[model samples]
Target: MKIFKRTKIKKYSKDGRILFTKEMKKEYTILIPMMLPIHFKFMKNILVKHGYKAELLNTSHSRIIEEGLQNVHNDTCYPALLVIGQLLDAIKSRKYDEDKLALIITQTGGGCRASNYIYLLRKALKKNKLEHIPVISFNLNGMEKNPGFMIRPSLLVQFVYATLYGDILMLLSNQVRPYEINPGETDRIVDKWVIKLSNELNGKSFFSKRNIKRNMEQIAADFAHIPVKKVDKIQVGIVGEIYMKYSPLGKNSLEELLAQEDAEVHIPGLMDFIIYTCDNRITDTKLYGINIIASFLAALLKNYLIRMQNMLIDAVKTQYIFKAPSSFDHIKSLVKGYIGTGVKMGEGWLLTAEMLELINSGIENIICTQPFGCLPNHISGKGMIRKIKERHQNANIVAIDYDSGATKINQENRIKLMLSTARLNLLKAADDSEAFLDNAQTR
Candidate 1:
């Protein structure tokens, strides 16, 4: 009568780190946070094709910010705050089956705070007692293991092609959309390609090297033919931290604002950043004792990406006036003394190189954006400004800080002031051109 049977107790994760289950394969949908709408739309297709219901949380409304503030620390980085907020807002929206819903966040597995966002997101999910949901860290580093969404060779190759496709799409769209004869025609062409490429990738063996090359050439020709109404619009180059440089929300809709003011926007391809991060592993091995195999692999992968990028750039050059971006090594050489590869704080010397690339390409007006109190940005961006300006006299560089408290009007006002100076110079140059032609005619 005194002997009692022992009971086994199971412990559940309170931090939303639950492993994705087999049942989730049937009904659960994966929610991915969006940085660029076009890129994520294509990426979403790839995920869905791979036997998962993947959706992009593409909203950038106030509600997202509100949800993020409630769950995430205010002093944390803005991109993380926005991303967490968007996901939490969706969770609390009462639209999805909570038990069948999981989240996928990109974990760079880097030295930056960005790599910790998955943990932050998990803590938030747990606080709301939604820890039963799975969190997948999307990365190539193989740092953190997830039972769900392993990257097979085919899947990995598809993703690399997706990145290359997104770059070409973004490059063509940004350059063409601003100067198109018919409003939204460029966007329509982009949407057409998005659907076409998604369908093409759905079939096995569709991502052949020959097919990829053909796709790039066709896309370049398609966008190049978009009837552009040429005007004396200011060409502005945007260089910033990875998030702010690309994410519309992270920069408070900076590209839209620039477009509204009739400025041609140029952003370096996302592939460069991917290559830069991979190259960092090699740099680390040299400086900090990673394995030789890892270093060799990193270098090999870096070179492969360059070949892909060069193919895309060559395709575009064949059809359009667009200038191809320099290789990673070329970018590094631009600021070799000013900053080093190991200075990899928030974009580090890459930010400096982008600015120089813009100036050399004749896009003299530049906007260097950063989150307020981002020390890496302060060190790499603002620190090297004077030298950049010293080298290029015509460079009109303005560094803008973005934060929760920063006003859109304030940021736009600063840009408007810069544009005012730019317009005057443009007009002066026009007058000089006419005068020189008249003198030549008289002679």
Candidate 2:
């Protein structure tokens, strides 16, 4: 197979629309998947502010899965299917002119299927008779530079900020909700803040780091009064590819299901991705004979990410009280031993990284969610479960595969069985410990 390193073609034509333009009219629409709901909204508002019209398609849950199976290879990763299905669904909507539509998805250019997702999405579109529609693959590496879309540096910064915000909020909400006095208050709070911040970010002046810090602080302060239990509950960690961890659609809403089961969810937050990306750059330097400067750059980025995560921890501590067992140092320790840096980015090594972190933190039970057909996840997730469990006898793990053809009730039943075993083991351990203490005292 040949690899292409060039950016967008200098000249291209699709549906009679020429590539290259500073101005965008209502004629073109950009479509994105559900994981980027907030992102798409922010982009839409910003694009409209910049005089371009943007529309978002509602593509998530079973709809994305069904579309994926119908259009894409069953063996492909779920992200590819969901994304492709989203574009196909949008094109079929007939709300937008077919010739004026374009689909957009992030391209990380890593070793995983994610690198080929754009091409797959394009093929799916062409097969569906939507060949004229353009597929815009966004990459920081400048992989694609069509005139129809250009991601300004400022816009990228805002997108990063949005990811951090979304990730942190999701983390806090998961921890708070299981024990909240009002069951849905945390979710309501998240909704309120998402709207507030989305509107604030739409402005020209609110895109600075200083402002982002202030907003993070304000978000913490806003819901500071929500009541939560001070006692410890069963802490269950979530580990898998990035999508399964972040997007409910990808994992079949596994986090919510765990919360409903009265378990405190503890998945490593998004700041880890920043650390992982930096680490990858250093790895690239070693592999490609690049400069040591990449390693230095990675160290600098790690320091900043560590500092940011510390701030987030501080804020979360102030608002929602839950056990944070390991510091960044402890969590970082797991990254090297379990999953090496050579592992492809975005969910491959990251999932293994999080699983190891959870075990190190004394989180004995974990639910590893993988898309039904995601290959890398299968290898790193269920593939290594036996080894992880062998190392830690108390490890209670279950792997759930999500796809359109899968039934929800059946998935829940499997998780329930795992939870039952975990609970029983936990109770037996406590009893044994108490018995040993009593016998020692009597002696």
Q: What is the TM-score of each candidate against the true structure?
A: 0.93, 0.83
lDDT over C-alpha atoms for residue 116 of model 1: 90
lDDT of 1 by residue, 105-167 (tens): 888877788889999999899889877677878887885655556777877888888889999
- Best of the candidates, lDDT: 1
lDDT of 2 by residue, 286-367 (tens): 8876758757877787777667666666656665444443455666567565666577545656677678778876788898
The list of candidate 2 runs beyond 4 A from truth reads 1-26, 36-52, 61-63, 202-210, 229-233, 291-303, 323-329, 404-407, 425-443
Q: What is the C-alpha RMSD of each candidate to the true structure, in Å?
A: 4.1, 5.7
Model 1 backbone overlap count: 0
Give the worst 10-residue stretch by lDDT in candidate 1.
1-10
Clashes of each: 0, 0
| Cα lDDT for residue 26, candidate 1 | 57
